[model samples]
Target chain A: MNRVRRNKTAIILFIIPTLILFCTIIIVPIFMDVYYSFFKWNGMTAPEFIGADNYIELFSSKAMGFPRTIKNAFILAGLSVFIQLPISLFMAIVLARGVKWEKFFVALFFTPVLISTVVIGQLWLKMYNPQYGIINSFLRLVGLDNLCRTWLGDGRTALPAVFVPILWQYIGYHMLLLYAGVKSIPEELNEAAKIDGANSWQIARLITIPNLKPTLQVCTIFAITGSLKAFDLIYVLTGGGPAHASEVPSTLMVDMIFGRSRYGIGSTIAVFIIFLCFFFAVLIKKVFKTEVD
Target chain B: MHGKIGKGIGNKVIFVFLCIWALVQIFPIYWMFTFSLKDNSEIFGKNMIGLPHVWRWSNYIDALKVGNIGRYFLNSVFVTVATIMITTICALLATYALTRMEWKGQKLANSLIMLGLTVPIHAAILPVFIVLKKFHMTNSYWALIIPYAAFALAMAILICESFIEGVPRELEEAACIDGCGVYGIFVRIIIPMMRPCLSTVAIFTFLQAWNELMFAVTFISDSKFRTLPVGIQTLCGSYTTDWGPIGAALVIATFPTLLIYCFMSEKIQESMAAGAVKG
Candidate 1:
């Protein structure tokens, strides 16, 4: 009995510090966000009591409303699922199939994943620089100078321009994940499929694709959530500028809270972003029936 | 014989396609280095993608001296090291306890940690900022260091637990029978055995700290204390674009990470592959 008590005390000593830190950093902040969502304050002065006004404004088409930001997030989410996933999966399949100098190629592809978002934003910004950028220079050299418009500065292309870098940085990461998934499949399965007269494409489509469902589900969740929470790259690239064309929820929230000093609205946006992420996460989980064993 | 020919052709096509894709992947980094070495005129010259007219090595020198690149580099190094130290130690201890110690609330503890994974750092920015202000930690190393450690705990704990699960408990039992205490056993027997995972944690923590931006922007106010990402932002002006120096500064900022990635690419790839499979 004495030994049991002693062991319990040791466990408490071990666990308490991490538990306290987690509660302070995570749990409290979530509740605070929910609470602050109900009020209206600029964070500089007093918070005015405004019940459900922030949320009601969420659905309304007011300037700095939540609906538009959510719409942008949805669009990004769609791009991630449809565009990013397919291309990254294709790359993963190709890369996994015994390329020469595999290590060098893997390193080259994964380099962007290790770079800072700010640098990537800056690099892409310069790459899209209208006059001196390689993109425009190549266009001119190929006799298509008329087609080269200001990529990031133009409103129509700003969101897509932002999406390109995010896609570029993360496609390698997803590819690596999918490659791991492909490798985990038993080699015997591939050999058996080959014995049954299956070609490479046939084996991959029929065997590899079906078995990669769990990995695909996880990758999809990460991509979707990552797209919705996208901020630093977009913020650095354009600061949601060229007339707020690339305004994600996180950026809009930061602008309101820090730039505009509207705390309550910022909190409302934060709360909304949380809900959106949770909604999508839960929706994906339900669709895929993802469960931890 | 026909089937063999077709298969050979298909492999050749795959090889060519991957080679082109590899070029696309590496082109931007190549452009960054090439542009950094060029003068302003060459940067805007007609042969933009061609060889630089002059290899202006002094641009790097100017970037180091004039652009405060040295200061930003030092700041990033300091912050990254401090964050890695705190996170690695805290995560190692906490994960060891969770996995090996006879804890009463192990399940609840694990569930709470899992909850931390879903709580995105952005959602907590406001309250954390308010808390930091209350403690007068804003603009201090404590501001960045504390938050970096806190936010990283979920991933560290997850990775560490996975590693510790694979460690043989027999070694710990042997160490205990030889009069080693729990702490001693952990230090001597367990930690040395978990070097690969520890290095994996260290590298990941370093990369995360090095690449972080939003928190630094939000929490830091002083120019001297700003890390590379935020410092690079101030290099740009409202109207004018200093293409030469900005590109140079970016090259200086990015070189360390690139070098590390080159050397440690295999290990990083292995760890990431392991993470994906385990997940």
Candidate 2:
């Protein structure tokens, strides 16, 4: 009894500082986000309780076009899972099979993942620079000068322009994750398939892809959640754009709090984002849940 | 015979394809570097793609001296170091208590942390901003450091949990028999064993708080307290046409992270992979 009590006191001593910080910063804010979502205050005055009106406004406000932003996030998630993951998967498969200088290419690809996103934003911003940027310069170099308008300034192209760097930067992260998974797969499986005359494509499709589904699910969750949280790059690149063309929930949340001082609406957006993130996370897990067929 | 030839061709194709992708990955950074070394003439002139004719070493000086990047760099370094030390120690303690010691509320604490891993900081920062504003912590170092440490706790604790669980409890028994208490065992036994996970956790936390933007951009309205991301954002904004110094500022911001990653890529990569699998 004395020993257990002593250990209990020790545990409390060990846990309190972290417990206070984490709970205050992470847990309390979540509840507070929900609490503040009901108010209509400017974040300075005492919050006037408005009773879900902010949520109503969030859903109905055409100007916010929050659903559009949510749609955009989902679109990004789709592209990430379908386009980005496949590219990374292909690279992982190739690297796993056999390639000289494999480690060099892996490090090269993953370097961008380690890079600070703000710097990446700056790099891409310069790439999308109107006058002397590479994309425009390349267009001119290829005699497609007529196609070059301001990539970021033009709303039609801004989202895709922002998406491209995001796609490039994170491919290696997913590639690494999938590569780790690929590396762990039994080599005998591959050798047996090869002995049975499976081509590289067939071996990958038949053996590797099936085994990689769980890792793919992890990459999916990361890609989706990451897309939902996409702010810094877009914030630096377009600041949601010349006209809110690339606005995501994160940027829009910043806009609400700091830009418009609509703290209530911002909290409302925050609450919705939390819900969407949870929804997608749970949904993805369920989709990837192993079924005993 | 034909199959061997076909396989050889396929290898050649995969090699070329990978080279193109690697070039795509590497070129932007190299291009950024070259422009960082060019003057306005060379950057805005027809030499956009080529190497800088005259290396403008002054771009670094200009960016640091004029662009507020130096001050922001200091701020980032301060916040990053503070966040790392606080989070690492706190997470180590909490994870130790949870995993290695007998404790009530362990399951609850673990679940709360799991919940935290899912709670996006950006999504919840609105209220946190309000809370900080109420306390006048805005624009203060505490605002960034405290939150950075707190936000990092979830992942750091989670990673440490997996590692500490793998640590054999037999050592703790031996220490206990030698008159060591829980704290003594944790400090002397578990801490030494946790070196690998601790480094990974430190690197992860460092990268996170260093590169963080949303909170920095929002919380620190004062330029003096601004970190590298916010400072670079504004600097790049103010100097849109001056690609040289702006790229230099970016290169400054990107340098330390790229250096560390290049040196310790495998350890970092495996840790991140471990994190994903554990999740």
Candidate 3:
């Protein structure tokens, strides 16, 4: 009886603080978000119970502008997979192999990961400055002055321009992860393939790529979730600029909450963002399980 | 054989490609520092990469004055330290329980932590905001500190759990036999043994809190309460097309991370690799 009591006390002492913090920060807020999604409140005023009106407006109201942000997120997700994934994979493979001064090179590639997104966003904002930014200046020097555009100021180029810095920052991180994965593969496998007259490309395709499935799945899920939730870089770069050209759901929700003071609408957006993250997370987990099976 | 020569050439080609890619990686940061040293006119000049005509060291001074950079720095320090303290203690206890204790719902607790790994911050922001408002905690330290701790707990626990599992069960048994209770065993035996993993979690937690912008921007409206990232964003908006002070602020912001990376690159790499593998 005394031993049981002691064990109970230990468990209580261990779990209580964590439970309190998580409940307050995560569990309770999630429930609040669900509740707020059905209301009409501007944060300061009393919330009016509107029974799915917010979500209904979110789906149907072209003026509320959730679809555009969703579209931008989808485009960002696609570009991340199509452009960032391959480049990072190639860089990881090259960096992971027999090379002199590997550490220095790895650090060089990984530098961007250490930078805050706000700084990256601001730096790129200056970089893409139409008047005197380095990009345009270089274009003029190379006699391609006509190619220069107001990258962030233009509605057409805003999304692509903002994506560059995000891609730059994350590619190195992905490369580092993939490099670790690639390095874990036994060197003897490569040696055997080479001895059997397998070409370098064949070895990479058959052995290296197959072996990197787990890493790839991880990277893909991270990319998808990150792209969907991307806020800081976009917030800093253009504030979803040149008229909401690069608005992501998170940024849009932020604008609604802080900018417009529409807390309930913002919560609705937040709920949708959560749903999206959960959806992708579940899909990835399912895919990983199936691969294991 | 031609095959050997071809392979050697291929290796050299790969090396060259990687070096070029490295240049692309470093160029923006290199440009940032150079631009910071230059005056406003030179910053917007046609020759973007040229040496500064006059190195105005006062660009940093001016940026500091204009941005209230000192207050922002203090705010970041306070929030980051509080987050680290809360997260480290809570995560250590939870991780100890999950890994060492024979709890009935250990599986459920573990899954809860794992679920946190995928719960995007945006998902919880609305509810968190409302709850904070209800408690009149908005714009207070609790607003940022609590969420930062919660968000980081999953990562901290994951890394610590892996490290704790590697610790031998015999040590705990011996400590218990010596009349050390569960808490005592954790303090004297587990924590000391888990230093590397603890350091790894600390580094990641610090970086996450330090660089975080979204929540800071959303939660804190007062300028004096704003963290570094939010402060920098405000500076960018006010400075608009003026690249000189903006670049200076960015350089100042990036300096700490650069200094840490310069000295601790290998450790950071190893920790990150370990975390990725376990994750």
Candidate 4:
């Protein structure tokens, strides 16, 4: 058995294919992204190396709006953590306490996540349609006609408007994670708290929330990192316009590469986005760590 | 008794809230179905929320015929199927080697593969385009499949690794002692035991490749090789005056996923929860 398990030929044969593919397609491209960021190439000519210029321009060039996109992403992340997670946590706790149609609600809530982001974007597009959308129609019927404007067309509203559906789509996802965490807490722990004259709020705050620390940490990381990389819905809904108001790093990267042929700048944005994700991921883990210790 | 009454009221409030949230979650899909069957006037006019007056089912036909969504659908299916097969097979075999086999750099290799999870798809776009262009693989199905499979591989391997770890070594040892070789033990013993894990990987891969918009849009410009999400976006662009056809295209694109979820929501949820730990 030991001899068979240590067969070098079998091991090499089994792992080599994936290792090569993963390297070429995933790992190699990441390094290439970092490498390409230092060069000024238009995708047609020989690349000219301009070390750190792209990065410098990406931050200092006001026209690039890179900082604004990052700010927009932070706002989205803020809303996701503060608003979306609480709603999900509320739903998870209620359902975990045993409710009618518990399984049904879970399945239903997760349906949006199953559907493509493009489809969700389109649905919300119609829902936000100024002339005949349900939102405008309701606003008109209720005599708040002033609120009826092109939600995706106005620069002031485009960012938040795009965020509504993006946030809406993921509620069930966070809820499911927290739901699993809530369910995994032993029933006896809750029973003991109850027997000690702890009310439901006390039990939830002390027992459930602390017990859910790991899951909450994971959820926070996902929400923050996901916000940093948010692209599809914003692309579909606004394309980072009315005037680049809704641009996130991912969309800005796409615009740089395809829209303007600024491949080097695009790679710079890509690298920045990657850095932000790793930075936030580590920061979030630290924050969650201190709370537990 | 008063406390019991208060508890009843609380449950009632919670139920109502849950129902409302569920409705908010599902209303859009239901609305999509209804609006897909409505013409311009009904969709924009009084019949927005209620049932369509005419139920113009020809909108689906129009989407297939005029919008050319069928070609894109087939393209998406082909790409998604290839991605699933490549990702699952590679992930399973590599996981077997990583977990069961003794090797010098096994831990290092496992960590490297796991690191693939942190590398977002956006980070690879520009460089991959350059790589694909060098090979002249752009505008081909392989362009989409190779990258999609690569991106999905890490998560699939993670899922497979956890499942394979649970299987006792006794089975493999017994098989080996009974004259089975490494290949024989892997195929005859391990592969059969990995059905659930494989399915989870397949489903997760399907979700990734099927709805992928970024790479599909970036790499493949040829209409002949375009996938559903891209096609649907184009359909939306072209049919700006009339949205019923766009809704129909969305439904057509969404149907397979919804159908899969209907049967395997539990599996999908479990897989997503596990795969999501990468973030």
Highest DockQ among the candidates is held by which one?
4
Record all residue pairs in model 1 with backbone atoms less than 3 Å apart, i.e. clashing.
Answer: none
lDDT tens digits, residue span B61-148, model 3: 8888987877888888899989998888898888877877776888998898887887887777777777777887778777898899
Candidate 3: tens digits of C-alpha lDDT, residues A1-293: 22422487888898789888877777777778888888899877789999988888887988767999999998888889889989999888777765877878888998999888888877787788788778988898899978999999999999889988888889988888888889999999999998998876788799998899889888889899999999888888888877888888988898888889887889899888889988997898798879878
Q: For candidate 2, give the lDDT of residue A285.
A: 88
Q: Give candidate 2 misplaced runs (Cα > 4 Å).
A: A1-6, A290-293
Q: Write the per-residue lDDT of candidate 4 for residues B1-279, one digit (tens) a residue.
A: 339889899889989988988899999999999999898888887688888888787999999999999999999999999999999889989999999999899999999998777678887888889888999988999999988999999999988988997888999989888999999998898999998788889888998899899999888888999999999888898789888888899999999999989988888888887766544
- Residue pairs clashing in model 3 are none
Candidate 4: TM-score of chain A is 0.98
> How many backbone collisions does model 4 have?
0
Better of 2 and 3 by DockQ: 2
What fraction of the reference interface contacts is present in each model, in order? 0.54, 0.71, 0.70, 0.74
Question: In model 4, which runs have C-alpha deviations exceeding 4 angstroms?
Answer: B277-279
| Model 1 per-residue lDDT tens digits across residues B148-193 | 8878777778888998888987877777778777667767987788
lDDT of 3 at A85: 89
| Residue-by-residue lDDT tens digits, candidate 2, A201-290 | 788888998998889888999999989988888888888876788998889989988999998889888888888888889988888885
**Which candidate, 1 or 2, has the higher DockQ?**
2
As a whole number from 0 to 100, the lDDT of residue B57 in candidate 3 is 79
- On lDDT, the candidate that comes out on top is 4
Residue A108 lDDT, candidate 2, scale 0-100: 90
TM-score of 4: 0.98
Q: What's the i-RMS for candidate 2 in angstroms?
A: 1.9
